[model samples]
Structure formats: C-alpha cells, structure tokens
Target: MLKGSAILEKATGKDGTQSNHSAGKLLMIIECLADKSEPVRLMDISKELKMNSSTVLRFLTALVDNGYAKQEPETARYSLTYKICTLGSKVSSHIGIKDVARPYMTELSMLFGEVVCLAVEQDREVIYIDIVQSSTKMLRSMQRIGHIAPLHCTAIGKLLLLNYTDEQLDHVIADKGLTKFTESTITTKEQLVEELQSIRWNGYAYDDEKCEIGARCIAFPLYDVEGKVIAGVSVTGPTARMSIKQIQLKLQPALQIIGRLRKELGYTG
Candidate 1:
C-alpha cells in the first residue's frame, strides 16, 4: 500500500537516523524503483525522494553498475533488475525450504540412490533450493541449488506450473518462450497443456530427458497449509538408470514422501 516517496522515507531506517545515510539512500532508491510498476525517470525519483537530481543520478549510476537497476537510453528511465528478484529468491529459499527439506531430501537420495532436489517456482522458472547427491554418484544430475530450469520441461517446473490457472499458464509460457532444451522438450502450448492434464491426473510429473539430453526426473507437488502448491520434491538421475519404467515405479514412493511432507507443512488437503 506504500507509495514511492513514502517507501524512500521509511528505508531511511526506523529511528530516522542519518548514521547510515549512504546505505539508507541506496535502499531508498531501490524501494522507490520497486514501488513503481514500470520504469521511472530521474526527475520522478528525485522529486519523490525530495533529493537533488544530481544525487539521484549518482545513486542510479551506482545501482546500474551493481546490476541492481537498469536504465533505458531512449527513455532515460530506471527500473529494478532481475538480479534483485534472483537474490531475494535465493535468500528466501535458503531460509525457508532447505532447512525443512534437508532430511527428506537425504532420505530420498538414500532410498533411490539418485539425486534428490527441492525446488520452488519463481517467474515461471523452477529454482532448486536444495540438492542431495546420489549415494552411488553413478547417475547424478547437473542440478544444484539456485539453478533455474524452464517450467515446461523440468519435472519440478511442471509440477509447480500445474497449479497455475489457464490464463496464468498462458502468460508464463508466452513470456518464457518454451525454449527447447532437448528433442523431448514440450515446445507447443497444446502439448504442454495435455502434459499438465496428465500430471494432474497422476498427481506427479516426469522430465523424461526434456530439460537435458540424458537426464530424467520425477517430481511431486508439495502443498502448504492452505492446500496451495508451494513447492516440489524431485529425484533425478541419468536416463539409463531412470528410464520410463523406473520413473513410474519410483512415483509411488515419491508420492508417499510428498504426502508426509505436505502434512508436515500443515497441508490439510
């Protein structure tokens, strides 16, 4: 509910102290940019923050240099960068999912003898929050914490996207452009929708070397207390070791684990 200048003012700190002036100003500029739905001009930021144009330009330059903000040359307007969202997501996933899912991920790795991953959706991309290496290490995957995979191809990504409404799904797919990572990747909206229907009916999803050439992944959705899909739990390995039959067999145990995990997260449904 906060507006541009108010956001800037509050970023100055709770005590309204000038001790951390530079840091506060930087945060203020970020908040001001974040408050806007689109890029804002230098004069707008300066006027909103009650700061001089020169000071605003200096802060903007610093922010742009640090990859936190970008400027449009023709428009001369500044906007927050994807870097802010990426950093925020990393911090959030580290603080939230990793600690809670670590034991479960470890158990999955031991049981399946394959890599276990915990991930959540962000901007239609799946970001792995935690990973447990395979015990055998013979069929390990390339996924790691903070790795981003397309929502239409990866198992966890599809699991997360399955919960989206049709309109939302279409928007995400349009924005992300379904870049094919492998021959098996779903490149058409119709194909993806059909796959999503199957995922819903099966209560799980499979990558089937769709994200990478020789990797296979099976993922189950994790729900929050509200029965909202909050994240996904997946197992990954080489396709040779995780063939279609093998993935189908692993789906049951994965479902059981996800059911317990959902309950642990207070999911009533």
Candidate 2:
C-alpha cells in the first residue's frame, strides 16, 4: 500500500468495499471484450471481471436488448452493435472538442499540402477524432476516424504529453513504456520529458521520421476556452519533401489558425 492510498482508505472508511455502479460494470464488460484477443465470449467477461456468469449474461442481454450490443446465436458471442456508432456519432457531435477542431484541421491540410490529423487523449494514447487530407491526387491514406496510436511516438502524442506534470508524465511512462519504431523514435522516459518540455516552450512539436521511416510530422497543442491544453492537431508528410526546418517554418502557422478556431468556439485562450 502506498502512503496516500493508506490515507485514502482510512478517510473513506470502507477500503474493502467495492463500488457497485452499474455504469462502471457496463464499461468493465466493454473493456473485457477488448481483452479477449478474439471475438468475445461471455466466459471471458465473467472470468476477467470476476463477476458471475449469470450477472454478465444479464448485463449483456440488457445491452443487446437496447441495441447497444448484440450476441451471435450460433456462437453465443457478443459484439458491439451498429447502434453504438449512431450513439457515438450523436455524442461526438456534441463533444465540443471535435466540433471546434474540424475547421482548423481542414484549413491546415489545405494550407500545408499534407495530411492533417486531430486527436484526443484516450486513456494514455491518442484516438484520431478527425483527419483532413491534403489532396486526393497525392499519396494519401483513407483516415479511419477512431484509429489509435501511441502517445510517445507520434507528433500529436508528444504534443499532448506537454501538458503533463513531471509526476503525471511518470505515470504515462509506466502505463505505456516508450516503444520505438524508427531510428529517430524516443525510446527512453527522460528523452520524452525533455522533448515535451521544449514543446511546451515552443508551442509545437516536430516528429522527424519517428512513427514511420519516410513520414515526418509536426503538431501543436489545442487549447480550450480556458487555455487548457485538451487535445492536439498534426500535419504529416514524406520526409523527403518536408524537412525538419520546413515543418517548423512552413506549417507552424497552423498553430495560429487552430488558436483562432478555438477562440471562436469560446476558448478564451
């Protein structure tokens, strides 16, 4: 037991008691699906969460009943339903961060001649919320809106890390140790801290051939109304065409545009 955890247990006065929140249970079931390593089985949920099989079935039945999920009759396996996407779309529309970032991301790709991506912190990683392609004719990937990436290798990843304190950054490092992809990838904890510190001061990041060999990326912190850095936007391109300095000099103006869009959305900063 850590010092603060023992203090918290004494204060809360019921350390052994577990929370019985239904919403928490539902989310735990969803997370259990992710751990199955294959299409989910009810047994996986029960075993992983240590909940009763009957209880897991009942919860899953309720989700299936509501169209939030579905079970395969042939296999007795369950998966998220199409309705989840509809519900997700409805939720994303009102998330405020995604709504505020769309136009700036669009304009950045148009101005930079590269692919622009907007991502938000999900757990200790980044989930792509929006992507704007530079041109249809250029070598471009169809951006999947919900794809996730490591928060230590990509430009947007490091940009988000800029907001963390020394201790929170330590937690991130412990949760997801730095993984290397290319020769330039920062694989150590201290190096990431130094990089984030510079990003905090310079207000932008340059990922030089880190995630992919030929790819170079640059990103900046996106502030909400109160100047809180909640998310980030990045522009990616081939390293052959976009040099390190060019990423900073040519596309650095995207920061100003993103700042204006945030302001329009009532972001005071």
Candidate 3:
C-alpha cells in the first residue's frame, strides 16, 4: 500500500530540485478532498497532508477558482466538484471500456453479419461508445459511436438497467418519461417492470422492433471483476433477418462469447 506522500514525491521527482512541486501539492490536495465523502475542513486537509494552513489554503483557492472544487458557505468546508468526474469520464471514454471491448464486438459482428454495439449508462441514458458495423452491404444500422438512446427501449439499454432498484427505476421513469418510438415500445411502468423481470429470468434482453420499426436487437450484460454490470454488448439487424426465432437460435453462441469475455474481465459470476 503506497502512501499518498510517496506517490506525490514520485510524481514531482525524487530529487528535491523539481520545479513542479506546486503542481504535485495541488494534486495531493485534490486527492485529499476526493478521499472524503463529505465536505472537508481546511485545517483537516492541512494536517493530513502535513502542510501549513496557508499553503493548503492557497492551493484550495486555486481549485475553487477553477471550478474543480467548491466550498460550502455555511460550513466553510471543501469538496471536489463534478468537474473532476467530467475529466475522469473524458479519459475513461477514450481508453477504458471501448478498447477492452472492441475485439469482442468485432468477433460478434463477424459471427452474425450484424451490427454490434458497446454501451454504458450515463445521465439516465445509454451511450454507444464502440460499434462494429456488419459486413452486410444492403443495410446498416443508423446507430453511431457516441449516440445516446433511452433506457426503456433498446435491448442494450434494458440490459444495463438490470441492477437498478425499484426506486431508482421509478426515478428514471419520472425524469425521462418513456417515449414510444414504435408500436411495440413499452410506454408504461407496468409494461417496463414486466419486461425487466423477463430480462432477469432469461439472462438477456430483446428489442422486437421497439426502437425502430425494422430494427431488432438482442443484448447481454457485460460484468466487471466484482460481478457488477459495467456495460452491455448487443447485436442489431433488420427484422427480415433478426426475427425472434433467429435471435433464439443465435443466443447460445452469443452467450458463449460473452462468457469468455466475462472471464477475461475477471468476473466470477
């Protein structure tokens, strides 16, 4: 377990001659603020980082000035802002899940001659981060990387919601009302609750021309090392080629590939 001071020293340089000492100290203060769930006092941060109160205040002032942190007017305590999470999300979108899942997406696309997508939940919607287009020349899915879809309509979106509690689900419905896109689209809480139950029992989700009239999809949950649903992978195609029967026939092979992917991701269940 490397301590924060050790990391700070390494980041600044072991030799005490580094010019980036201020940058390192700023980062240390940021980490100190992040480690706490509630707003932290100025003196507590100074004591924990072994720095003078004035020095910590200077760095904290800079952070607050830049919108990376906020100070409570009543409590006079500091805490990190959503800006930190914004920076982290930008970095993770570029190098994390998309990179690890692209090869598997390609495999699925090649195996099925259909579009494959990788998606994660953000702000109550599913965002497609990576896509492997099918080799088929006739028709291509309109979905593109970075496109967002509602959580109640698409197969991948429903799959990603497997872990949401009833209260959370209700909140989502209240925030983003289920807008119907097609005749089969679920438009009420009761319908969505029943659909989610079936998804849980079947270990997968299906979109039967729900999102778009001719488009259909089948999706499975992608798990992290802790057995949490981190994302979802789905195959989409035209209704002519991806009827319910066809989706059922392809289910086992898709599950096999996903099983291998889960193992690689260190998911035990």
- Pick the TM-score winner: 3
For 13-84, candidate 2 gives per-residue lDDT tens digits of 334433235546667886676455556888877888998888788667766666667888899898876666
Per-residue lDDT of 169-199 in model 3, one digit per residue for the tens?
A: 9999999999999999999999999999999
Off by over 4 Å in 1: 1-23, 26-94
Q: What stretches of model 3 exceed 4 Å from their correct place?
A: 1-94
CA lDDT, candidate 3, residue 35: 90
Q: Between which residue pairs do clashes occur in model 3?
A: none
Using all chains and alpha carbons, the TM-scores for the candidates as numbered come to 0.68, 0.63, 0.72
Check candidate 1 and list the clashing pairs: none
Q: Tens-digit lDDT track for model 1 on 152-183?
A: 89888888886789999888977888998888
CA deviation > 4 Å runs, candidate 2:
1-94, 140-143
Clashes of each: 0, 2, 0
Q: Judging by TM-score, tell me the better candidate of 2 and 3.
A: 3
